[model samples]
Structures are given as structure tokens and as C-alpha cells.
Target chain A: MRMTDRPSNEEGALAPWFAAGREAAPLPSGEFMARMEALALESQPAPRAAPAAPARQSRGPGRLLARLRAMGGWPALAGLTAACAMGLWIGAAAPEAAVDWVATATQEQGLSGLDPASGFDYAMLGL
Target chain B: MPYDAMTDTSDEQLLAAYAAGAPGAARALTARLGPLAFGHAFRMLRDRAEAEDVAQEALLRLWRAAPGWREGEAKVSTWLYKVVSNLCIDRMRRRRGGFAALEDVAEPADPAPSAAARLQERSRAEALEGALAALPDRQKQAVVLRHLEGLTNPEIAAIMDIGVRAVESLTARGRKALEGLLAPRRADLGYEDD
Candidate 1:
């Protein structure tokens, strides 16, 4: 249909008709507004308190330990310490076993062994 | 600032105030958005209770999102219109029966005049609404947002998530369909008198 056939103003040919509709169908009742306000208030977040002053700033190992504690507390720190100790022991005691395991796994997958200097043999893999 | 000062605040600022737990911000936001949402939903669904539910849910979502409401991202009214439109469309999809006929739909009482002219005006509005209800969902939405809600084509496009060209096409087709539907009642609607 041609746009020119309709009223050329803001609401087309039915602007006055719609205006009457709007007047007849006004906004929701006061009860609806009350319910909405209640719902909105119910969902509104609680106000945040202002930040408190810090006691002291940590430095060096103290800061590192604080960071670890903040991450997951004593258990996490202990776990990290245990992991580092295990790594040291494995490197010192069973380096050959680790290398053999890597080489065997890669060979089984039809891949080359690791280069000690640069990790994987990307050249052999045609990279 | 005091909570009463929020009456003149922008929607974004009012939302921020609401997130900050200001005293009157919730009421302010509700008062501002409730009518617009309800009116749009009512126009779409033509059921007062269902439209009320849709409006409440839409505002509830806005309240939930207020904490993370980023300023300057979009106009708050635009966002609410998008939400209301989606909810209305979903309700329309789940509708099992045909559109409500004019007599079946509840009419809000006209308090203006007790004369025949008032009756005719009421019928004209109802007829337009019925014609609107008979339209396909997208076309109905496009026409409602364009004509009744007085939104620009670009704003309708953003709300409907379609291109401006698509909005234009939907509204054009919707207007044509509406004209055809209302043609039979043109005299009753007093178009002949015009």
C-alpha cells in the first residue's frame, strides 16, 4: 500500500484513533505500581560498606605467602610446597624415567622424541 | 543527594541509585517504566492480566540487571521495549486459540461522554485494536511500535532486532492488512464522516 494514502503525520492515518485508545487504556492501576515497587525493592542489592584501612603491606616472602594464603589458605600452600618438593625429588632422582616416559608416549603416537634444549622436535613433525 | 532528588534523574542514574539502595529510586524507576511496559504489553496481548504479568516481569528483569547496568549502552526505554516485545511474542506463540473477537475482549469504560459519539469512538479504538490483533506477530509488533508507540523506524529496528528495511516492510504490510480489515467498518468507524 502507498504510504501517501495514510495520514502523513506521526501516527499514520489512525493517530487520533490510537490517541483515544491510549486514553481509554491508561497505565496500569495504582496497585500494579505498588506491586512493581515492592518487587523492585525486593530485588534491589544491599548497599556496600566503605572499605576499611589496611593493617600493613607485605613484602618479599611475606607477600608471596600472603598471596598463596589468599588463593586457597593453608591447604593450598601445603599442596604447593608438596608439589615443589616432589618435582625436585623427581628431577634429582628419576630424570631418565621421565624422559623415557615422554619418548615412549610420543613414539606410540607416531611422534618424535623431545629435544632437551627446545622441548618438542617441531622440525621432525614437519612444522 | 537526597532520594527525592532522583525524581528528575536520568534512567541510567536512577538505576544506579537503585543499585546503590537509595530510598526512593525503586519507586521512581517503577513509576517511570511501569506504564510504558504495561501499555506496550496490553497493546500486544489485549489481555489485562497477562499484560500486567508481562509488564511486571519485564520490570523485574530490569531491576535484576540494574546492578550491572552500564551507562550509555542503550536507552533504558529501548531496553524495556525489547524485553516487553520478546515476552509478548513468546506469549503469542504459546497462544493456542484464535485472536480474541471484539466482543470477547474487555472494554475499559469510557468516562468522557454517555452519547453515541463516545460509543462510536470506543468502537473505533476497539476496531483498530482488533485489526491489530489479527496481524501476524512481527507485523503487529512493527506497526504497534511505529504508530501507536510513536517510535522511529530505527528504534523499532533495534527493539525488533531487524534491519530498518525489514521494519519498513513489516509495517507497510501490516498497514495494508489493517486497511483491508478495517475497510468493512470504515463507515462505522466514522472515516466517511472525515
Candidate 2:
């Protein structure tokens, strides 16, 4: 800011004219002030919360979402869902041969047979 | 802050308060700057209606800019000066009548005791305005901001987006041009009476 503090004697003889100009400087009318005040108030940015995140429901729609995209989207998700349901159904009602083999193979190892869904059978049988 | 209490606040603080939706902050801002902006525009554009539009537009922009307004980066008045000047220049460039529009300018009559002196003062002012209007846009802006508006060179530099030396040069040239234009009418405008 190594500049002069103010404009120098450039006005000189023109000083009187400049003085008149300043004296004659326009005064705004009441209508203008009111209009400006209203505009200022109207244009104020309201105190608002940060914008609502579009993913408000899901906290981290990040890596999992990217993984879903990589796995071929909703169709792949549907396929995966169907596979899970089938796996649960088959595990509950597996072939008795498989259960027998598990019992025989694990007897020496002192492990019991896998007997998932046996409770449901007992409840149905009333024994 | 309340409207009354904001009288002593800096323009930046007032603007921040307005941005935060503080009650009466907007009114405070308008009250503080409305006349400053309007006077500059009126002197630049001459027509009261056009001046009002430019002033309103600049203040409106200031309001919109309030939220992101960085303190210490620039003064609010400087920003308004820049905006108002540019808007007036734009209007001036679009219209083809030169300073013939001076006829449409509104001059408030002085309440001086001597009617003759008042008329003479008005004539001096009008002569000055006519000379000012004849100047190139940059020169007129520099001169007005310097002599008439009484802004410092640094403030004028910020407002004009130019360097201090450049502001100095423009005002110098403008003042010279004005002197030459108004020289012949010195006695006619009652400067001799002074």
C-alpha cells in the first residue's frame, strides 16, 4: 500500500466545480430507500440447515453401493436373493443319506450328527 | 444484532448478520449503503430511474453475496462501488444519446437565501456534470470516485480493479479534460463570483 494517502492537487481550479458537484450530489428519495431496503431483506439468504443429503436413509452408501454396481445391479441382487432362499430351504430339508453319512463319519471323532430342523419334526409328530 | 445496535458495526459484520438471517440486519445494511450507492449511480448515470435500478441491483447482489462474503478480503462499500460503477457503465454504453440524457437528470433545488446564487450553483454543477458526462467512461468513473465521491486512491483502485498508479493517471487525465471543458464557462457559471 505504498501509495499516496489521497489524490493530490489535481482538482486545483476545478476544486470549486468539484465542490459544487459534491454539494449537488444526488439524494435518494424515500421511495428509493424503501425499495432498496425491501430488496435487501427479500434477497437475504435464509438461515437454513445444510441441505438434506439425498442418501438420508443409508448412512454409508459407499463401498457396498459400489459393490452392488460391480455385481450387475438389481438383477444380480435378485439372483443372489433367490440363491440364498434355496440354500436355506435345502439345508433345512437335506437328504437323510447325507445326515446318516455325517453321523457315521463323525462317530469316531466324537461329533454328533447335524440335526437341523429336528425340532420342527418333533413338534409335528407330538411324540 | 438489533437494528439500532448495528449502527457501529462494520459492513462485513452487518453483511454476515444479514446472511445469518439476523433480524433487521438487512434493513441496517440498506440504510447504511443505500444513499452511497444511489448517489454514485445517480452521478454516473444521471437519470434517477436508471440510477435507482443500478443501485438496487447492486445492493440486491450484495445481499445474495452475503452468505459467502469473506471478511477482510474486500470492503462492502468497495464491492458496491465496483458493481454500481460497472452497471452504470453498461447502461451508458447501451444508450446512444451521449449526455443529452442530462436534460432528464433530476437536480434538487438548493434552499440558499439568494435565488441567483442557487441558480448559479446549479449552473456550475450542471456544467460540471455535462463536462463529466463528456469524459470517456473510465476517466469519468475515476474522477467521480476521486473528487466527487471522496474515495481514496486505494479504494478507487479496488473499485476500478486497477492499480493505484493507474487510478492516479486516470483521475489526472480526467481532471485535465474537465478543466478544459469547463474553462470557457467559468464566468458564465458564476465561478468568478467566488
Candidate 3:
């Protein structure tokens, strides 16, 4: 019979050879293990250097004042005030605020002479 | 397995302890992974002398990597496997023609019928080793791991850093190629004895 006709397990004559190969195989032991461990340890990346500590400057009234000014100078105060005003304008222009303001304005001044409510809201007309 | 000096805690655990400055953990890990690692190196290197050197270098790498080995990331075996495979690949490239895979290089052909058959068989097997050595790097590795070392596809894949499907393909191809290579000599290997 052709070798292909024999199933792998039925290749009985070859079994002993296979078994011998398996049996004679070496096990992981002794000097071999030590050598592998050494190789493994060698492959590790080197440790990083510790970061340098930040330089310390003397702290007193002068330094404190300087830090405060850096944080909140006149330009910063002006920018903050402008930001707050813009926030107020944005808040007033919100749908809810717009609705309220329009209602109050319409009540105070009839539809003829009206303060333009930020933008038109047809929801006020129940549309 | 009995948790003896031979085989105890896992390599990962030992590495963790070693990272934490447990002085003995390195030796423990060395004992555990040593044989398989050396065998792997030997298989690729095909030279006992070079295999031994590579194995030593590989373990030294493990020792160096130990201190910074982050906890709970990758298994120690997985890490070692990749390192060893890469090292073997590099060594194989650097010294391509240095070693032959088989221990028994050229057994004498027997003069007597009974003695001759045995000697011829040994020589045939040794010659097959040269053919096995001639297989491509990945195919050789797959064959060695799957058949000789008895590693499963997943283990081989993890060591190879490839998908399981790829490992299967490599092993299947390797086996089929080996069978083809060895088929004509089947009777000589005593396959037809029965």
C-alpha cells in the first residue's frame, strides 16, 4: 500500500522511532536554566535616571507679590471683566432669558416701540 | 507538578519577586526556564557551544529586565519567549553556516545484516537532521516547537508573537514538508518493518 493509504496512527512501524525521539529529548534543567535566566535578565532595558528636583527660590513678600501679579495683572483683570460682561450677554441671550425679557419688554412697551429681543423666537407666539 | 527546587512558582511570580529585590528569585527563575530556553537556543543554533552561549546571554537579559519588570502586565514566559526567539534569529543570521542540527553526524553503515540495518538507520536519521536544518527559519522553529518540544499552537504563537492561525499554517506546512522530505526514506527508518 502507498504510504498515503496508511493513516498516521497506523504507521505503527514508525512509532518506535517517534517514541525514541520523544523519550530521548532533553528536559529543561540545571546549567541550562541558569544560562537562560541570565540571558533574560540581560535583555531588560536600563533603568531611567531620576528626574532633577526643581530649583528653590527664596519665598518672601517680594516673590509672593511677583507671583500674584503674574497670575492677575491689570491686563488679566481687564480681560476677566470683559469675559464676565460677555458671559452676561450670552446668558441674557439664552432662550429662557430671551423669552422672559421679551415678555417683560412687550408688557412695558407695546409692540410698536419694541426693544429688539436678541433674536426672534417664534416659540413666544406658541409656534 | 511538585513545587520543588526543580519546578515551583511560575516564572512570572519569580520575576515579580526578583523585581521587588528578592535576591533568590533570579536563581529560581533560572532553574525553571533554563532547559527549555537552552533547547530553543540549541535548536536554532544547532551548535552546542553557541547554543550555550546564547542561552547564557538570554538569561543575563532576563536578569537585567527583572528590576524594571512591571507587575501584572505580561507573563514572564511570554516576555522571555519573545526575547529568546529574537536572540536566536539574530544569532542564526550572524553565523549561518556554523552548526549542524544533529548530534550523530555520520554513523557508519553496518557490515552485518542486523548490525548494518541499525547503523544505516542511525545514519539515515542523522541525515534527516541535515534536511531539517535546511528548512526555513520559521518552519524549523514551528517543527521544533510543535513536534520536538511538544508545545501547542497557542504557546508557539505566543513565543512567535503571531496569531494562532499563522502558527497553525507554519506547523502544518512544516509537517507536510517534513513528511515529504522523509517519505522516500520511510522503509530505511524502519517504517515498513511491520
Scored by TM-score, the top model is 2
For residues A16-97, what per-residue lDDT tens digits would candidate 3 score against the true structure?
A: 4444444444455556555555544454334444598887767786687686699787688789889999989878767797
lDDT of 2 at B68: 87
lDDT of 1 by residue, A1-127 (tens): 2354232353566566666565556479899889988998899888766698886765787888878778898898889899999999999999999998988987875443344533255567766
Query: What tier of docking accuracy does candidate 2 attain?
Result: acceptable
Question: Model 2 has how many clashing residue pairs?
Answer: 0
Q: Rank the candidates by DockQ, best first.
A: 2, 1, 3
What is the DockQ for all candidates, taken in turn?
0.27, 0.43, 0.12
RMSD of 3: 15.5
lDDT of 3 by residue, B67-150 (tens): 777777777776666677788888776767644434434553343456755555455545455556767778777766666566
Segments of candidate 2 deviating more than 4 angstroms = A1-4, A48-127, B97-114
Error of 3 at B138 (Å): 0.9
| Residue A4 displacement in candidate 1 (angstroms) | 13
- The stretch of ten residues in a row with the least summed lDDT in candidate 1 chain B is B102-111
lDDT of 2 at A99: 72
Q: For residues B1-194, could you state the per-residue lDDT of candidate 1 as single tens digits?
A: 65545566888888888999877888888888999999999999888899999999899899888988888999999999999999999999899366555445445355356677777777777878888888889999998887778788888899999998899899889888877777777776687897
Model 3 segments more than 4 A misplaced: A1-19, A27-127, B1-8, B97-105, B108-128
Query: By descending TM-score, how would the candidates be arranged?
Result: 2, 1, 3
Alpha-carbon shift of residue A79 in model 1 (angstroms) = 48
| Among all candidates shown, the one with the greatest lDDT | 2
